[model samples]
Every structure is written in C-alpha cells, then in structure tokens.
Target: MAIHASPRVTEILAQKYVEPLRESGEFAHEIVESLRAYVDNQMNIPAAARSIPVHVNTLRYRLRRFEELTGCYLEDTSTVIEVSWVLEVFGRDL
Candidate 1:
C-alpha cells in the first residue's frame, strides 16, 4: 500500500495544520520536524529532542509554540493521538 501526496490531502491538511505552520514563520520547518520526531518517539520529549538533533530546551520551546498556535496539548493523550494521526496521514500523503 503505497500512498502519494495528493492535492486533496494536502489541501485538507493545509487548512488544519499547514496554514498555521506557514504563519509560524521561517523556522516553521523546525517545528514540524520536531513534532514529527516527537510523535514518532511516542510523544517522548527527550527522545524527540535527540531525534531532532536539538537540545531538550529547544524542543520544549517548539512544542510550546505548537500548542499556542494550534490550541492542542501534548500532555493530553487524545490530543497526542490525534496529532500522531494527523502527522501520519499528512506525511503519507506528502
């Protein structure tokens, strides 16, 4: 089952998350990268930091900003699961 980046998927994601990232500024990629790694690591902050090749403090800052921008909470299990899926679907499509 191979998936490709489709315009429809991208467009939907754009409305849900991408648009916010775009407004987050030039370093938005860092936030996305960190978030992907965070979810990949089962939402473990320290592991996410190591995976992102950044210090824990940096990742914390990005996560804070992510919550601020999205009104999503990393500490919440449901939010974490939702975000993980969003990242998975969004990445698979891309």
Candidate 2:
C-alpha cells in the first residue's frame, strides 16, 4: 500500500529537519539562495543555476559542499523533499 502524508506532517518534518540547514553558517548566502531556489523548483539544479547566473558545475559544487557541511545529502530524495518543504514554509524567515 502506498502511504500518504498530510501537509501539516510534511511541514513539521521540514521544520525539524530542513530549516537548520539554511541557518547554518557553513554556506554563503548565495549558495543558500541557490539551494532554496533549486529545492523550490523541485531539484532543477540547472534551472536554479541559470536563475542564480552561476555555472551548473559551480552550483553542483556548492551543493556538494553544503552536504559535506551539514551531513545531509541534497540529492537524496528524502532530503530533497524535506528541504523543499522547509523552504516553502520558512524560507522568507531566513
């Protein structure tokens, strides 16, 4: 059976797991902005890079660095989903 999650539950999970990534000082504001945009766009890294006016490789490198700093892999489906939800719920606060 497929499991479905409520929006509130998703949001809560996001708050618990994702929001701290943005507040961390390990990445620059530009990198955080790029990551937020990418998560919002559903992991469209190339499009996010274009929006940020950075090279795709540069974006990838930044993302990798973020993962190293946070011990969270942005490319993982679960991590991406949580990060996306967090950005949607609290990105403006950051």
Candidate 3:
C-alpha cells in the first residue's frame, strides 16, 4: 500500500498504471488480454495471436494501438519492463 504514496497521488499502482489506459476511449479489455498473451508468449506475435484467437495482424494492430495509447513502444526495453510490470501486477484483475 505504501506505493500509493507517490507524488502523483494515484491509487494502487496497478490501478494507477492503468488509469491513462482507461481514460483513453480506445482502450478495451481485449487490449489488456492481448497484452497479457503477448507478454506471456515472450512478445512473440504468432504465439500471442494464436493464444488470443486473433489474427497475427490483429495482434500487431493491438500492439500498435497500445503503443499509440501509452506512447511506449513494445520494442523499448524500458517500456517493456514498465508494461510487463503492469501486467504482472494487475493481470489477474483484468
């Protein structure tokens, strides 16, 4: 709970992590699921797409959309760490 004491004054880290995402009208539960699948598959598009039961292109689109929404490129190590942390922390809630 101490993590909530950030200067940002957000709520739980997981909730805070997703705040901007939820504020984006384009955000969807599917995006979260896709993220989970994608990360779990080690960012492998083919495996993630198959796991999500979506086309690979669809998965790529979602990834691009996620980047657009968060301004965090999946190819970036820092962003990957941040997003993977978000997913690891809040994936169950999603």
lDDT of 1 by residue, 1-94 (tens): 1224555654554576656777867767788788898888988889989986999999999989888887777898876765665666667332
lDDT (Cα, tens digit) per residue for candidate 3, span 30-71: 788888888889989999999979999999987887777666
Q: Pick the candidate with the highest lDDT.
A: 1
lDDT-better candidate, 2 vs 3: 3
Better of 1 and 2 by TM-score: 1
**Candidate 3 wrongly placed segments (more than 4 Å):** 1-17, 24-27, 92-94
TM-score of candidate 1 relative to the true fold: 0.74
**Regions of model 2 farther than 4 Å from truth:** 1-27
User: Cα-based RMSD of the predictions, in order?
Assistant: 3.8, 4.7, 3.9
TM-score of each: 0.74, 0.63, 0.74
Instruction: Give RMSD (Å) of candidate 2 vs. truth.
Output: 4.7
How close to the true structure is residue 35 of candidate 2, measured as C-alpha lDDT? Answer: 78
Q: CA lDDT, every prediction? A: 0.74, 0.68, 0.72
Clashes of each: 1, 0, 0
